[model samples]
Target: MACLACLLALAFVAAEAQQMQSNISQGSSLTPTTNSTWLSRSGLYAFGFYRQGNGYAVGIFLAGIPEETVVWTANRDDPPFSNNATLRFTGDGLALPTAEGQNYLVKPSSTPSYASMLDSGNFVLYNSSREIVWQSFDHPTDTLLPGQRLLSGNELFSAKSEADHSTGIFRLKMQNDGNLVQYPVDTPDTRPYAFYSSSTSGAGENVTLNFGADGHLYLLNRNGTNIRNITEGGLPTDEGKLYLMRIDVGGIFRLYSHDLKKNANWSVQWESSNDKCDPKGLCGLNSYCVSIDLQPDCRCLPRFEYVNQGNQTSGCERNFVADACKNRNENFTYTMEELESTTWEDVSYMNLRLSDRNDCIQGCLEDCNCEAALFDGTNCRKQRLPLRYGRRDTGTSDRALIKVGVPRKPDTDPRIVQPGNKKKGRTGILIIGLSFTAFGSILLLISVIVWWKHNVWAYKRMSAVNGDLELNEGVALRRYAYEELEEMTNNFKEELGRGASSTVYKGLILGTQKPVAVKRLEKVAAEGETEFQTEIRVIGRTHHKNLVRLLGYCLDGAKKLLVYEYMSNGSLADVLFTRERQPFWEERMGIARNIARGFLYLHEECDAQIIHCDIKPQNILLDEFMCPKISDFGLAKLLKADQTRTTTGIRGTKGYVAPEWHRKMPITVKADVYSFGIVLLEIICCRRNVDWSLPEEEAILDELAYNNYHTSR
Candidate 1:
C-alpha cells in the first residue's frame, strides 16, 4: 500500500510539472483583464500582465507569495493601459500596443516560434531549434534575484514604493569606467555623488554585477576576474535559501535573503552603506539629516521651519526676513547659533582662508548672501540660504554658524509722543489716560505677585511628591543640572570612550564622591529626543546586577546627558581585543553566563519585555570584580506580552546583526540569541567574529563553526 501511494504522488508531481512547462504558441495573447498567466515548470515563477497603478505591467512574479514580488518587467517605464492592452505572441515577435495605437514589437531573429517562463524567473523567446532569442533577464527592473547577471550598460531603477510601481529616483548600474555604482537619478549630472561604488580604480570595461546563488553579490571583469565582493560576507550554504539584491527607493542598495525551509520572510543580510544620512538630497535643501537611533530624521536650522509643514524633505523657510542687500540696513544685527560637527560640502557661497574662528564668523556676518558658515578650525566656507547636504559628521572638528535675525523692538507709538509741542485738548486727554493706566498697573502688579507665589508653592509641592516616589521599585533617580554635570566631569577632560550616539567622560559625583560615567549625546532630531526619553525611562525602571544602573540625567537644551555608575574595568572589547593579556578561560565562561542572565532578565523578567537591539562587546561593561553588565539601551525596544515580534528598521553593528534584521522578517528575541551565539564563539576563540587577518575560510567564526559541525558529523 505504501509503495502504491508513493508511486501515485510521483505521478501527480510529474503531471503538474508537465502542465506548467507547456509552451505558448504564436498568435496567443495574455492580458490583465482576462487574468491570464504562464507558470514555470517548477511552479515557482509566473509571467503575466500585472496591475501597476492605473496601467498594466508585463512582468515575472513569484507564484505563491501573498504580496507580488516582481523580478523582471518588460515595459516598466511604459506600462500599458489596464483593460485596453494585450501581450500578443506573433510570428514577427512579441508585440505590445503603445498609447498612440502603434504596435511596439520585440523582434527576435528567424521568426520567433514560442515563449516560456523558466523556473529561474527568466522569460525567454525560443526559435525552432529551441535556442534562446531574447530573455527578460537581459533587461531587469529593480530587483536582481540569484543567478541573475547585470551586464555593462544595463541599469536597474528602483520603484517609487510598494504601492506605486513607477520608476523612482535611484539607479544602480555598472559604469563604463569599470565601477558598479548606485546613485540618485535626480542629481544634475551623471557624476556619482553620495553613491556606493565597487572600486576607485578604473580596472577595465565590460564589468558585470552578479547575484550568486550562495548569497554573494560579485563584481566581475570581462575576463571573469573577480573584481570585488560588493557584499563581503559569508554565504548561506542552505539550498532552500533564496537571495536577491535590490536598490530601494531610499537610495540604498540592500541584499536580502529568505529561508524556504523555515518559512521565514526576507531579511536584510547586507547593505552598501549603514549611515542613514549618507543619501544625497535626503532632506532636500537647507535642512540637516541626523540618525536618531539608526533612523534618519530631518530638521531645519535655527530660525527656520519646514517650507511645507507636512513634508520635511521640502526643506525649510526662514521665520524672519533677512536684511536686504540693496537696502543695506546697518542697524540689523544678526544672532549666530553654533552647530557642532555639521557640514555643507558642495553648497558653499564662498571659501576663505581665515586665520581665526572670529575672522570666519565676521566674514559670514559681512556677506549679505551668507546664511551659514562652516569652519574646520582653518578655512571658512560661507553657505547661501538653501544649504544642501547638511549633515552631522562626528569624526570631524567642523562647526557651523547659522545666521538668525535678532528681534527688533516694537516701534514707539507715534501718536503717544510729540517732538516739539502738544495741543491743549490732547494734553488734558493724555493726563487722564496716564492716571487710569497707573491705577491699572498697580492692580496688575498685585495679581502677578499672587500668581508667582502660587506657582512657587505648586513647584515645591510637586518636587516633594516626586522625591518620595522612586523611579522604579528600588532605584532613585536625580535630575541633575547641566552646569552641575559639567563641574563634575571637570569640563569633560577625562575622556573614556566614544560611540555613534554619544561620548563618555569619567566624573566624580559630588557629596558622595563616587565615580560615574557621563554620556553626552550628540545633537539629534526630534526622534532622537524621544529615544533619549525611552532610554532614561527604561533604565530608570529596571534594577538588576547584570544591567547598568542609571543614576541621573540632564535634559538641557541641545545637551542630553546620562549619568551611570562607572565600570572600573572598562568595556569587554578593551579586555578582549585591545589589551595584550587574554582573559582566563573560567572568566570568559562566567562572563558569557552573566550576559545570558542579563538578556534573560530583560526579555522575560522585566516589567515589560525589552529587546536590546544592539548587543556587542563594546556595550558589555565589566566592573572591578569582573562582573559583566549590559549597557547602552539607546536602541532598546519594549514590547507587550502578547506580541511575539515587531517590525523595525535595521539596527546593531554589521557583524552582530542577525539574519532576520535584513530579511524584513518580524524581529523577535531570537535576534539577540543569534548575536549571543556569535559572541560566545568569539569569546572561546579569543578573536573577533569577522577578523580579516585570518584565512578566508576561517575569517567568519559562525561559518567556521557551521563547517566544523557538519564536517564532524
Candidate 2:
C-alpha cells in the first residue's frame, strides 16, 4: 500500500508540472467586459484584465490566493481603459488597442511566436527559436517572486497605497555598485538621501538582488557568488509554501510568505525598519515631526500658526509681525517668551558670551534683527527671521527666547478738541473728506493691479517649472543660485569629507560670514522632479534641537547641494574614540539621554515617523556646548502612519545592527531601541562596539555587558 501511494504522488506531481507550462498562440486575447483570463498550469497565477479605477488594467495576479493579489502590472502609470479595450498577443507584441491608440505593454526585440503565464508568476513572450523575447520579470513594478532577481540599475517602486496600484513615493533600487538602496521617489539618489542600503558595495559589479526558491532573499554577484544574505535564514522548504519580496505602500521593503493549505493568508516574514519617521523630510518647513501612539503628527512652534491646517505637513508661519526696529518709543512693546528644554538651527548671526540669562534677554530685546535667542547657560546666540528645526526635548539645556509684540492699551482720554470757528471747521472737514475719498479710490486701484500682477507672475513661475520645484507656501527656504554657492564655498576650496554619495565643504554665508557646511550631492535622480522638491520641503519643515538643521538648498540643473549649520565640535566618534580622556560618567549619561530624546522626537514627536537605522557615534555630531545632534540620514527608514513594521535589505554598520536584522522577523522601532542600547553600552565603556585588540570575551561590548549581567546575577 505504501509503494502504491508513493507512485500515485509522483504521477500527481508530474501532471501538475506538465499543466504549469501551457502555450498560447498569437491570436490569443483577453477582454475586461467578459472577465477573461489566461491561467497557469496549476491555476496558481493568471494574466488578465483586472478592475482598476473607473476602467480596467492588464496585469498578473495570484489566482489561487483568495484575495487575488496583483504581483505585476503593465503600464501601471497609464490611465485605465474601458471594457471595449482588448489585450492581444500578436506579431507586434502584447498590445492593448483602444479607441485612442495602440498601447503596447511590452515591445519585444524580436517577434514572438507564443506567450505563456508561468507558474512562477512570470509572463513571457517567446521567439520562433524558443528563446525569451520579453518577460514580465525583466520589467518588475513592485514585487519580486521566488527565483527572480532585481538586476543592477533596476528599481522596484511601491504602490501608491494598499488600495491603489499606481506608483508611490518610495522606491528600492539595485544599484550598479553592488548595493541595494531604498529612497523616496523623486529624491536624489545620493547616500545622504537613502533610507536603507545593503552596504554590499565593492562586492563586485553587476550584483543582483535575488529571491530564492527556498525563500532566501539576498544579493548575488556577477561571478555567481552569494555576496550578501539579506535575511539571516530561509523559511522551511515546503512545496505548499510561496514567497515574494515587495516594496510596500509604507515605503518599506518586505518579504511575505503564504501557505496554501494552512491559514491561506499572506504574512510578513521579514521587514527593513519599523520607525516611519526614519525617512527625512516627512514634515514641511518650520515644523517638527512627532509620533502620537506610533502615528506621525506635525506641530507648529510657539507663536506660530499652521500654513495649511488641513495638511499639517504644509508647515507653519509667524502669527505676529516683527516691527522691533520700527521705533523704540512706539506703542509696540517687545517681550521675550521663554521655551524651556527647546533647541533649533544654530544659525545665529550674533553670539554674546554672557553668564547671566537676563543679559541675554536684554541683548535680544535691544537688537532689531534678533527674532529669537538661544541661551545655553554661558552663551546667548541671537537668531534672525525664519527659525528652523525647533523641537521640544528634555535632554538639552538650551532654552529658546521668542521676541513677541505686546498689545498697546487704548487711550484713556476720549474728549475731542473744540474748533475755534464753526463755519471754518465745517468747510475744512468737507474739503478733507473729498480729498480722502479721491485718495482711497486711487489706492484701491493700485492694490487691484498689484494683486493681478502677483497672481500672473506666480502662475507663470509654476508653469515654467511644471510645478516640480515649487515648495509649500509655509516653506521659507532660501533658493541660492549656483553662482551664489560657488562664492559661498570659495570655489569649493575647503574639503570636509567625501563620502560615497556626497562631498562636504566648509563654506561661509555670503554677507553674514557665518560658517556653514555645504554638501554637494554626487548624483541626482531627476526622474521624480516633483518628488525631489517635495522631499526638500519636508526636510526644510523639520526643526529639532537634537536633529541637524537644513538651512537651505540649491537646485542648479544637475548640481544638487544642501546647506547646514556648522557643528564646531565635530562628531561624537572623534570625542569618544580619538580623545585620550573619555567623557565623565554624568556627561555620558546626559549624552545617552540626549540621543534617546532625539530618537523620541524623530519617532514620536514628528508628524512623519523616522527610524535611524544606522545609529553610531560617527553619525552623531556635537554642538559648541557638547550637545549631541543626530546626523547622517543615509540609512534611515520610514513607515506609514498605521504601519509599525517593515522589511527590507539589511542596513547599518555591522556591529550596531539589531538582532532582528539577522533574524527572519518583521523589524519595528524596537530595532532602533536595540541599536540605542548598544550605543549606551559603548558610551559606558568608552570604546567601539567591536575591538579585536581587546580580550576575546570583552571584544564585543554588548556581549561583554550580557556576560557581566549574568555573572553578577
Candidate 3:
C-alpha cells in the first residue's frame, strides 16, 4: 500500500508538470522593464528584450539560470531599442514596434495564432492548427543551442566584441559542398583563404552541423549518417546544465557549458583551433602576426611603422619614401633586411633561379623595380608594394628580404680643411655658395615658367584629342601602347570571342604569367573611339567584385583595345548551351544572384548611375570559380547625378533589347531591368531566348514560361 501511494504521487507530479506548458495568446506582449519575458515551461529559456550596449535588444536568453546568457538575437545588426519598444505576439507574428519602425522578430509564412517558448531553447510561432509557421532556431545569431542545426550555406558570424552583439570580423560558413570553413569577414570563401575547415568536402548533400545535448558537435549527412565528429560526446547532461557552441570575438569557434547550480561563469569545453594567430588578416597589409606566450600580436615589417598606434591590425606603412624604385639610380643605396621564419602570400611579378644566395640578393639589388625578394636558397622572387597575408611560422624555409633605402651620410672631413684655417675658409665658402644659389634660383624660375606654358598647351591639345579620357590610379588602370598590346597578345593570334564591336584575344601580362583578355575594337575609325571613351570613363571609375576589372586600355592612333582580367570559365552562354552536363541548380542560382548584384551596384549603388545597354548571357562572363562578372561596357550609358533617363539608339542584342528602346521613348534604368528579366528567364530554363530547335509553342523562352505559368494556374 505504501509503494502504490508513492507511484500515484509521482504520476500526479508528472501530470502537473505536463500541464505547465502554456501557450502565449496573440495579444500577449513583452517590454524591457515590465512583463519582460515569455519563458519555457521549465523556465529554462525566455524570449524577450535584453540589455545590449546602451539600450535593449530583442533576443532569447536563459531565464532559469542565475547568469543570463543570450543565445539568439533578432536582426543582430540593427540598432538597439529604447524602453518604449514593445515585442508583441500579434496575428502577423512576433513584432517589435519601436519608434523607428515595426520590426518582425520572426516573419511567419502563415498567420500566427499563438507562440511558445520551448524548453529546448527554441522560440516558436504556430498557426490555428498548431503547425509551426516560424521559429528562432531557423535564424541563429552567434550561438547554437542543443537540438539546433546549421544547414549548408548558412553562416554564423562572431560578435564584434564581448559586449557588442553586432556582426564582427570573422565568419563560420557551412559551405554548399559539405565543408565547414571559417574565414575573415569580407574575404572570399575560397579554400586557400580559409583559416579553419572541417575537411569534409565530399560529404553527401544535406549535410548539417549539429551540437548534441551530450556536447557532441558534429556533421551529419543526408541519410542520418555521421560524417565527422568535431568534438567527442563526453559531458554531463544533468538538470540545470546547458551547452552552446559559438564563434567567439577572437575568431575561435568554441563550445561552452554552464551549470546553473554553481551559478558561475561559462566554461570552455572545446575550441576549433589552438593557435591564436591562425586567422588571416589578424594583421592587415604590410604587417605580420606573431605569437607571444600563445597570444596574437601584430608587428610591422622592417622599416615600416604602424598605421594606427593603438590598433596594430590596421597594418603598417613605410616610414621612408616608397618611390625609391621609381627614382632609382646606380649610386642609390638599398639594404635588404632579412626576416627569418616568415612567410607571406607570394604574389611575385618576376622570379629567377640563381646559383647562390649572394646572387639572389645581388640580383634584387640591381633590379630597380624590385621592392622585395623571397629566397628559398635556389629561387629568388621579386615583389612590389603592399604585401599581404604575412605571418611568422618557425617551420618555413623561405626567407624574406625587404628592400629599404639607406640615406646618404653627409661628407664632413676635418682633414680637408686645416683646423686653424677652417673658420677663415667658412666665410669665403658661404659667400660663394650664396652667389651660386641666387644664380641657380633665377635660372630655375625661368625654366619653370617655360615648362608650365608648354605643359598647358600640350594639356589642351591632349584633352581635345582624348576627350576626357582619364583613368584612376587607385584602380591601377594603366594605358598600354599599341606595341605593348601586340607583345602581350602574341600578335593577336589566339581569339577567344568576337562581338559586333570588338574581338577578345587571350594575352599574358609581360613579366608575370598572368592571363588577360585583350578586347580590340574593330570599328575604331567610325565610332569605336566613342565606345573606348565610354568604357574608360565608366569601367575605370567603378570597382566591384561582380564587374570585370578594367586593368588598362590602349589607344595608339586608332588601335583601340581594353585589357581585362581573363575569364577562365568563359561566358554564361557557353555554360548554358555548349556544355553536355548542365550546371548544378545551386550554381545557376548563384550566377543569377551575382548578375543581379552587379546590376544593382551599377544602377543604384554607384556614385553616378550606369545602364548596361546590353544584358545577355553572352555579356555575363564567368571567372575561374564560375562567379559571374558583367563585361563589355562598350554599349553602357552613363547618367549624371541628377539625370534619371536618357535618349539613345537601340543598342542591345536582338532578343534581349528592351521594348522602350524600339518605341523611341527615353530609356531609364528600368530598361536594364527589363533586359535582366529576359536573361533571368533564360537562366532559369537554361536555354536561349529564341531557340529554333524547340517546338513551335516553346520557341520563345519568355513567352513559353509565361504561358506555362498561366496554364499551371
The Cα local distance difference test for each model comes to 0.72, 0.72, 0.77
In candidate 3 the C-alpha lDDT for residue 573 amounts to: 94
* 594-654 per-residue lDDT for model 3 (tens digits): 7876876687555567889989999899999999999988889977756778999889888
What would the per-residue lDDT of candidate 1 be over residues 280-365, giving only the tens digit for each residue?
76686778988899998998888888989876667998887675432443334565788898766544524565658877776666
Candidate 2 Cα lDDT to native = 0.72
Question: What local lDDT score does residue 670 receive in model 3, on the 0 to 100 scale?
Answer: 74
RMSD of each: 30.8, 27.6, 22.0
Superior candidate under TM-score, 1 versus 2: 1
lDDT of 2 by residue, 1-713 (tens): 99999999999989666555558889878789773678887889988888887888788999887887999988898888788888888898989876678889889999999988899999988998999999998999999999888999899999876666888768999998889999866555667568798998667789998888877898889988998999865587687988888988767788888998785889988888766554444455566656577666777766788999986546788787655344443444566888887657666644566778888887777555567888999878777766654555567899888877765446723231111111111111011111223224224323332343233212111011111222643344556777778989999999877765678899999645999988887757753343345445544544567787777788888888888888887788888886674777667667766776677556654444667788888778888988898876655665565656788778788888878899857876667766766676666567898999999998987777666555644
* lDDT value, candidate 3, whole model: 0.77
CA-RMSD of model 3: 22.0
- Top-TM-score structure, candidate number: 3
Residue 2 C-alpha lDDT in model 2: 100
